[model samples]
Target chain A: MINLLFLPLVIPLATAVACLLAWKNQGLQRIISLIGSFLLLIAAAVLLVTVQQDGVLSVQGGGWAAPFGITLVADLFSALMVCVAAGMGLVVAIYSLADTEAEYERLGYHPLMQVLMLGVCGSFLTGDIFNLYVWFETMLIASFVLLAMGGKRAQMEGAIKYVVLNLIASALFLAAVGILYGVAGTLNMADLARMLRESESSGPIPVIAILFFIAFGIKAAVFPLFFWLPASYHTAPMAVTTIFSALLTKVGVYALIRIFTLVFFAELAAWQPYVLAIAGLTMVIGVLGAVAQDEMRRLLSFHIVSQIGYLIMGLGLLTPLALGGAIYFMVHVIAAKSALFLATGMVLRLTGTTELKKLGGLYRHQPLLAGLFLVAALALAGIPPLSGFWAKLALIWSGLESGNHYLVVAVALLVSLLTLFSMTKIWAAAFWKGAVVNGATDTPLPLSRRVYWQMAVPTALLTATTVLIGLWPEPLYALCMDAARQLLVPDAYIFAVLGVQP
Target chain B: MSSIILSTTIRLLLPLLLLFSVFLLLRGHNEPGGGFVGGLVAAAAISLYALAEGVAAAHRILIVNPRQLIASGLLVALSSGVIPLMTGRPFQSGLWLPYSLPVLGHVGTPLLFDLGVYLLVAGMALLIVLSLMEEE
Candidate 1:
């Protein structure tokens, strides 16, 4: 069972190699990618179940002992993250069959996508901070290439912004790691937690903590660091964008949660107010940015930033309920946001544009697509009986329970309302309004029925996942609560990784 | 660069550089030289050849696609890791043979892994350099 912990990392890597081996045959690459994704999903599910049963499963790379060698640990939180990431990988792989062009596939898209999965799953599962940095680099390189694959003028512009900002983040992250090693003398997360808790020296720890915050903050795309996201995300192909929406920022949030809970537990209280302030501003600014956008994808991209604020809010509250709510919110938002992006991709395909002024009457022409978009949109807006509503409810409930956070709670509520308004803004302009008489709008792209099903099915599956989670939030919430508990009490994690009683 | 002097120097230098890179790969286990540095040297050799000759000539000399080399190298590295798994050890645990070779010390999975890295680095570098050169 412990061996299964690394399967999430290994399977995607093997699949990427297989894809690369079959590079010339796009058809073969697609088939191999799909199969690989399915296997990964299964492996992730098994790993999640193993973690549920075993408490925390860790494996040392090359049979090295903990704190001395690289460790891959799968606690409930990492397991849940890996599971969701794998599911998204499979869904996007399926979606790519219809959405990705032959030219893109020929440019090594399939292998790069698997490599991206490998990096994501590796980041989630690694028990070492330096290992996490390596995975982040792997993910960054793959995403940079995927972003710039076509080398279109816009793509080049977007990729340049994306890479420059991300490289800065990577540099800061590495610098922080180096300083941290100088301070703590170890890169193992479990060991660091133990040392930080036991140490009397408070010097430079706070600075290191802040540096980490900034590094991950940029990746998470919080306030004042999110310019690259909207500038770049809308420029990528939709399949690439869909996976990025599901994974990239979430990985940053995951890293923040992991490092803060496990290593910086002593400093979280001191940082709470500032974290809350940042959270509130991120929510307001992101939604306002969305409200100002007329393009479909750019608006959704802004919403990704807004939703990240809520995740930070949960972390700020620092209560188990708040953290659990954040975890549940992460799962909900990935499904909801990916569904929205996939549906928008379909819109882009049918209308040859995602511009609101040029896109109209989708409700009349492709009612199914409109309905798919509406389900995901409503979920994003926190409507009843959808995943987002339950996520928000849990977060808000946790906020109210954690006293003296009323202002941010009010901000959260207002953000939800604004989210709804902007979602409807897309609906009113792109779907409910009359179709424009422009030449591009008049001639919808001719999509084959098979390709249409390929695209629609993945979007539907993701939407269904959101609806299912909303309708039956109990199991997931319970698991998330368990994860939150484990995160708050780091002794179990430390014991699992370092075999030491803290 | 169609300089006769540069091309003649590259022709004489290429075989020696390739041999030196292999030596580096083999000595990497206990020495400063390793797969990464070795691969870089080898890539420099090939890239210099491309500069002296042309990318088309370099491609003809390479025979196999750099992309294929990358894939095969990754496979080799992955298999090195998996070899330990078959023996029920953790992934990437080094497994050595009973006897040592002439120049290469105790033959092991780590060496095979290094070889894979060597091939992959060389392929990746060549791919980048060749493409950029082609664009020009």
Candidate 2:
């Protein structure tokens, strides 16, 4: 049963290879990639179901026992994350059928996308911390190539900034990993957590945690570490940008949540205040940055940074309810944010530009498209009966229950207002206003209905999922509660992976 | 790049480097010479061929694209992981044949996994190097 964990990673990787083999035939590449993603979706769903039934599941690599050889472990949190990522993979694969250019298809875009999914699934499943780093590198390289595949000037510029900063973060991560292994004598996460708890003097553990913070912080795009995100995210192709926006920083956030809860839970008392401060600042700065942006993608990119702050805020609160809220919020953002990006891509396709000044009359021209955008936009801004509302409300309620930081509640509410403001700004500039009467480039023809359906279908599906979750938050919330329980008290995870008491 | 002595030396050394790379790959499971090092050695051989005979000649000898090598290698590695699952074992658990092979002896999934890694590393390195060399 534990072997089932490998299916998610293996399926994508094999499918990536299949896609590459069929590189000359773009249609075959698409078909193979789609099959691979579909298989992965099934695998992730099975893994989630198995974990729920069997409790935390772990597999020892090469038949080696825990703490000696590599291990792949999955609890509720990892399983749910894998499922969401695979779902995103399936959605993006469908979207790419219409959105990816033929040139990109020939240049191995399908394979790279699959490989990116491989990295994501691998990262979510690996129990060994070092293996996680390898997965991060895998995701990084694939994304780097995808980002600059078109060789546009803006893309090259963005790719360079993205790669350089990430490389720095990688170096820091490796150094920290080295030191951590030195201290713990093991690289398996469960082992490290057990050892850290047993060790009498944790004087150096905080320093190491800070290293991980910076490493993951940069990747998560929190506050001061977020500069590279806005610069690079807007320049990729629609499919590439959408996946990167949905998955990349979220992986970083996952790492943060995992490391903090499992390995660093005992030390949270020292770190909680700092984390809360960082959370507040990240939200405020990210939304303000979004408010200043004119380009549709850049604005959304900055919003990613702000949303990350909320996830971290859940961590800062150090309560099960708060963490559950964070998990729920993560699910909501993944669906809503991707929907927003895809909707923007559709608008760009119709108008031939994503610049707010150049885009208008979307409401007049395409009411369906405008409505889809509003669904995602309203959800993002925490409107009632949308996914974001529940996510925000949960976090606020937990913050109030904690009764430590009244300011955090205030900042979060204020950020919601600002989020609405920015969404309104996009709505006004791109939808409500009439298209500016510029010359020849002003009025590009809309795509054929069939092609429009190709794009609209995925966007519509994502929006529906968002609204569905908002209306019936019971199932998702229950899952988050279980995941949060597993995270808060990681004895189940450790026992599953190591088969021993701490 | 234009030096005759250097080109001739590389041409002479290429076969030896490739042979040694294979040897390293075979011995990698229990020793220092694993798939990663072997792949680097193999890539170095390919790089030498590119330097000596030029990128076109290297491509001609390569026959299949390096990308195909990478993709095939990944599939092979993935298969090694899946092979264990056939026995109802956990993923990535080593699966061994009941009898010993004549030369390599006791062939197992771990070695196959390493072989996959070897091809992937060599292919990835050559892909990047050859692409750059061709551009130049």
Candidate 3:
């Protein structure tokens, strides 16, 4: 069904509305959100399959032609992204059933979460630059509320930093869009790509590209502009943080890849060195930040930043192999990272805190959770036979093949080691080491059996996904390679959207 | 802080402002006025009434909960987009009536979409204003 292209955006919007309508009944809201998320996952999967079979698919809104009306196109890259995002949304929806407090539900957590999904999916599927900006704002506003839902002191402080920095990024994005439109006279990405490629004069495009870089870099949490991530990610509820960790930065990276390959492909060579350098720095600094953290979610937050480096590294390499690696790495990281956060959420539920030093003896008390954490943690560290290993291998292989990118490869390897070390630090301190003889451990909070299972199931499911991808990497890897080819050669995408053979 | 002059003026002004907002909403299809500005005018009128009377009276006058208004407005807008899909058109394709109505001119999905935006914006503004005023 061609109309399936709009389902990813529509399903979530409808779900959020349904949740809002059932506001007074928290139980009803939960059921609605869960079903909505499940339906979204199915729709996304169908969309992905349709795209895989049909090549790039584009739909114009309100019966208008592309380059004029709003367009939603799904090539392999976007379809895959939407699929993974919907999967993450489903997992988080399940986890939120038990993880979210009734008060937050009353405060519209379910609807806000669905709105966030809508924004994320819209960003992935939109074919217009200005439309992408609108989706980003939609995601931003939903996340802002989700972050500060409880109005806790730390959340407020964190939300302020998050909002202000993100607002600046949005402003930059808008300015870039305005400038680009002024120069090219079109906001449709395919039209822009064709115009930019055909135009003899390339004046001011580089400036616009750099503006987009900084704007998206802030969202992606690349080296210099990633301060807001760690400052705020841990302050939100774990489920919120999990979704944020899974989708938000990846959206930024996806935008980077999309624009660099499509609209700004010409300027990529001029900007390659800067991107690679930033990737290296982001990886090193993020892991180092993780090593210094004793809090559970905070450590994971830093790791999120570090892993973003690898995604960017793939982009910087600018080869089909490298881009495929980056896409694969994105899927791997979403599963592995979200699992880690969900497990940490479990730890918080049982222990009432995420401070690693104050947590111990989990290996004895809750071996299942400990095991789940270990699997995801090792995956994050790029252990063998795990999704992360293959992701890293592909990136490293491409880096070496690219030649002269050895420094980043080395940084990446070293960062993997450091990531392992940080994971071990968490394992040793929180799970392996004996419980601290403090008031915090004397009386563990009694987690209801249902809640425990609800939290654990999603974590285990995600871990299983990582293990599955790790064990059977061929299908996903092939998809990513095809996606990479589509990205590298933009003519197909351009033609699909505008009905003109570029 | 309630003033008799302000209250008396608002009682007469509220209906006129609301009628003006509807005019703006209908005229938006061909003119500069649209749902967003129209919603703002309506919200401003109601808020002014709240200031003269009280938040409780304003809530009573509104009848429906602002939150419900937002939810329903969103549903309306979404359905407008979906209507074209059933008719074998792309999602959100504007489908207008062949015949133009008196005063309103041509009616279409765009008008319905604008109506949704009108309700949503008005509800959103009122919700914020009422909450903030109640907090004070």
DockQ comparisons of all candidates to the true complex? 0.74, 0.71, 0.85
Classify candidate 1 by CAPRI docking class: medium
- Pairs in clash, predicted candidate 3: A62-B92, A62-B93
> Fraction of native Cα contacts kept in each candidate?
0.71, 0.83, 0.85
> What TM-score does candidate 1 reach?
0.97
* TM-score: the better of candidates 1 and 3: 3
Candidate 3, A13-120: lDDT as tens digits: 999999989989999999999999999999999999999999999999877898888899999999999999999999999999889998899999999999999999
Model 1 clashes, total count: 0
Error of 3 at B87 (Å): 1.2
What is the descending DockQ order? Answer: 3, 1, 2
> Which pairs of residues clash in candidate 2, taking residues 3 or more apart in a chain or in different chains?
none
Residue B13, candidate 2: how far off, in angstroms? 5.1
Give each candidate's interface RMSD in Å: 1.0, 1.4, 0.7
Q: B7-124, model 2: which lDDT tens digit per residue?
A: 8898779889999999999998887898889999999998888888899989888898998888888878888888888888876788889999998988899888899999899999
| TM-scores for the candidates | 0.97, 0.95, 0.98
Q: Every prediction's TM-score for the first chain?
A: 0.99, 0.98, 0.99
Scanning candidate 2 chain A in windows of ten residues, the lowest lDDT window is A437-446
TM-score of chain B of each: 0.97, 0.94, 0.97
